[model samples]
Target: MHGGGAVLELAELAFRELALFAAFGFLLGALDNLAIDLLWLRRMIRRLAGRRDAAPWAIADLPAPDRPGRHAVFIPAWDEAAVIRAMLENTVWRFAGQDYRLFVGCYPNDPATRAEIEAVARRAANVRMVVCPDPGPTTKADCLNTLWRALEREEADSGTRFKSVILHDAEDVVHPEEIALFDRLIERHDLVQIPVVPLPHPRSRWVAGHYCDEFAEAHGKDLVIRDSLHAGVPSAGVGCALARDALGALAAERGGLPFDADSLTEDYELGLSLAERGRSGTFVRCRGGDSQGLIAVQAHFPATLAEAVRQKTRWVAGIALYGWERLGWHGGVADFWMRVRDRSTILAALVLLAAYLAMLIGFVLLIAALATDYTLPPMTPVLALLLGINFGLLLWRLAVRAMFTGFVYGRREAMRAVPRAIVSNIIAMIAARRAMTHYVFARRDRPPAWDKTRHIFPETAVPRP
Candidate 1:
């Protein structure tokens, strides 16, 4: 009985310590989020004070050029046979008359993907496949570099210089008006990123739907604030356009290879590098003909838990671990702060895991104490205060998530965001663990490799409205 009492006491102490740690971590995260929220709030206040029309710009306001400058669309494929055909077909169908060419990059080993791209290229006059010299499974950046070289050759042969370059994945559902939007925006901004909305999965709500929730919040609020603050807008890899001049400058700086082949998140680094060079980028949220929000790129994310884990692990590795090693902590205060927020995923995941464990253990202990007729000590005032603050912060976080999700998706999906956050937290914990392990092993001798996730393009096309 004495030993049992002692064990209970130790467990209680452990619970208290865990709670303290989690509360502290949560406070730090809340502070960072609050900073962003405050900045966004300030912008809203200023806009309101100026009484400026907050209406979204209509797509018709930006007319397509009569003589559109040539734009090159880069699609990098590896084992993407399942969706590449659909993607290319959609691209051709959407931008039939636009002065743009779809340049697809494929590997020699991925014959199925190559075949599909070839079939599409043969069908469409504007579509061309650029086969990489090297075999399969190289980084996406390498494939992009190969496509860049092919673009140069095409320019040399055809005497048509592409004014802008757009990057996209094989599974993306290309927006019909994106080319026109890019055509107009690239003239002003060096890099332009449109909102990327993940289409809701019909079956896998928990796993795939989480992506919708995240992106809705990220592109809707986070990126908007980042752009408003004059901090760089990181490229979302798809639905992003770079001016030809910017690409040329980057290539000249990097031995004629604009994309960093060694980096896992080259798209992200590219935007930052351009910003460092005093180039401008913007995140445009425009309206379509129906006065509804449109001009956003849409795609399906991973539908399974395993696939989500695989994709997020690569993101954590690239953005959090490898990014810190490569980019370091540089730039102005806002830039440095955003970088810290970006890299906080690893620590955030650990804290979440700890919080969940602490809750479970505490619940079990409470039940055990009641059964044994033993009472645990009362919570300290300071600990209670911390818990109250954390509870409020959690509620605020959930409300913000729901607001963003509802705004992009619908009210039904917004309600789901509250519970779906648990799914996201679990995936983050698992991905962080895998990412750290991979990064440690990669530091020895191996370089960062492309961790490809299988993509599924939806059968029924639901165009972005």
Candidate 2:
């Protein structure tokens, strides 16, 4: 009986310690969320107080160019035969009248993707395929570098310089007015990013729909705040345009290779690099001519748990781990704060794991105390206050997430956001584990490989406007 009682006492002690740790973690997370929440509230108050009559810029307000300047769209493909043709066809058909050229990069080993690109190029005069000198499965940045070289050669041969170079992916549904938008905005902004909205999946609401939730909040609120704060706006990898001068400067900085061939998230690094050099980057969100809100890019995200986890693992590895090593801690106060936010995923994942473990232990202790008539110690005032604040902050975060998700998606998806957040948390934990493993290997001098995810393109025609 004494041994059993001793074990019970130890169990309670462990539970108390775990709760304390969780409370500390929750405090940190709540503090971070509070900052963003306060910023958003301030913006809302300012908007309500002052600009009630003025409207944001609409796509229709921009004057049609007398002659469209040459613009290059770079798509780096490797084993993307499944969606490359559809993407190319949609892009060509949508921008039929615009003086834009589609430059596709393919490897010698990936003949299937090259064939798909060639098939689309055969029908579209403006589409061209640039074959890479290397074999298949190289980094996307390497493929982009190959395309950049091809763009230089094309400019030399045709004696027409492209005003801006746009980046996109194989499965993206390009907006009809996106080229025109880039053409107009590149004049003022050295780098222009458009919001990316992930299309809802009919079958995989939890896996794919989580992406919709994230992007909706990110593109809708976070990026807006980032721009307002004058902290850099990072590229979404697709639907972003880089001015010719900006691209040239980047290439000159690295001796002809504009994109970082070694970085997993080169697109993200590119945006920060431009900002570091004092180049202006803007995120444009506007209504299209058809009276519908138009985001620059829309595509299907990973529709399965495995695929989603794999993709997120790559992202975490690139942004949180490798980015810290390469970029270091450089920038202004806002920039440093954003970087901290970006790198906090690993800590967040650990906190989540701790919270779950604590909940399980606490539940067991609650049952034990009821049966044995032994009560756990009362909560301290400080811990109780922290827990209360954490709960409130969590609800606020959920409400913000739901607001953004509902604005883009309907009310139904927004309702699912709360439950779907759990799925995202689980994914984050898994991805964090995988990312740490990859980072460990990388630190030991192992080169990072392209962990590409298979993409899907919707069969039906994409909604335009």
Candidate 3:
């Protein structure tokens, strides 16, 4: 090839790389704009209005006329024996005084978990344990599926009726008053999402900070936007309530399909499917600190950076491969927009990977040109502005998170955690890329079995008499 042609080809490649980097930057920037303009503003305004202590919109007062109906607290357990007992204990203790029933979903192979759950049931008449017959690779979704089957058979025999179904994680320790909130919301909304706030350890590790950041951004700002726009708010895999009628209809429409079956991130997919199936799912911002909040659920934020990354990686991979195609976003503008947002989130790490490569190449080329006495491309003000704008936006996000998070880890501690979070990002990026690649290349496009996350339960603070 001619020297001139080779140089032209090289220049074309560089331009393409730059364009790809810019495109990713633009997508992230647009997402930032949406969060700030649509969601964060409401959160900030709510703060300014001093409405933090105000009562939740879901329930004005407890013991409303519609509080009493057959409601099932569906807790899907898979190898959760470590925390399952505590979770069930709290569920029973809290609901002991309520007018509803407690149903725990467990796998038969997990004898310890089954036994503990059974003991909890024996202690409380309102509690019952159902075995999930699936011997296939264990997933929370499968457990829920088995529970749904059991419920169906029970309803068939006795003609029992239920008004609502609430999902809770085994690690969760819900507030006593949460039942009332759920009862109130069930009376009005088809689906309702309650805030899942992280209960951070005082001496939390790096992963805890990352979890806190997610909760602050998602629960604090993200839900605010969903409320403002009247769009759907996805559940945090827990504290989600579904009206029994709508749930029954969804199940019937799907030929009595499991509530969340064969999906990695079933909760998220469930929420999206509900929205697509013409159901309204909304959020309620409850009042107070984590301890004083209306619904204080004890959930362990990944104790280590590696665990956090694994969780996010599975989420990104699951959502990208299974959710987007199945959600059917092409049907309408709203669906399309939701898909767009979900895609942008899933692609964030990929975009960053591309941008980093481009920047590296540009840097190496600039250095070689300087050393070789060759003319280099001039830096433009627009490029500088673009870089500054991107950095500023990220900094703004961190700042917003810090402001609302209230007395977070010290600056030194945060800096230590940042690298751990970065490591997590790298792992998640690799996993997401692999999942996406498999989705496009594999002959069978079926989703792999869900790998349950290992929970490191926080040591309970001993109560002083």
User: Which of the numbered candidates is closest to the native, going by highest lDDT?
Assistant: 1
Give lDDT tens digits, candidate 2, residues 1-465.
213387777776776777778889878887886788788778777765766432245887665655457899999888899999888888887888988889999989988898999997888889999998978777889889999999999999999899999999999998888888888778878898999999999999999999999999888777777777778888889999999889998899899989988888999988988998999988877767776566459999999999999999989988998889888887799889888888889988988988888788878777777777777667779878878988888898898899889998989999999899999999999999999998886654544566788888988754353
Residue pairs in candidate 3 whose N, alpha carbon or C atoms collide under 3 angstroms: none
Candidate 1 segments whose C-alpha is farther than 4 A from its true place: 1-4, 42-56, 60-68, 290-292, 462-465
Error of 2 at 66 (Å): 10
Which portions of model 2 miss their true places by more than 4 Å? 1-4, 45-57, 61-68, 443-446, 462-465
Residue-level lDDT for 110 in candidate 2? 88
lDDT of 1 at 117: 89
Residues 1-465 of candidate 3: C-alpha lDDT, one tens digit per residue = 112345634854774567457655754655655555555565556756868643343345333745567677788777777887767776676665776667788776788888878877877787778887765356777777777776677668869777788888877877676667777777777787877767665565555666765665567666656555556566667888888888888888877864656566788887777776778887777643345544535577676656666676677756766677666464365455556666665567666676666767676666656666445555556666666766666566555555545434346544544454455456556767766765677554454565667765554621122
| Ranking according to TM-score, highest score first | 1, 2, 3
- What shift in Å separates residue 26 of candidate 3 from its native position after superposition? 4.7
User: Which scores better on lDDT, 1 or 2?
Assistant: 1
The TM-score that candidate 2 achieves is 0.94
Estimate the Cα RMSD of every predicted model relative to the unseen true structure: 2.6, 2.6, 4.4
* lDDT by residue for model 1 (110-185), tens: 8999899889788789998999998878889999999999999999999888989999999998888888888887
lDDT of each: 0.87, 0.85, 0.66
TM-score of 1: 0.94
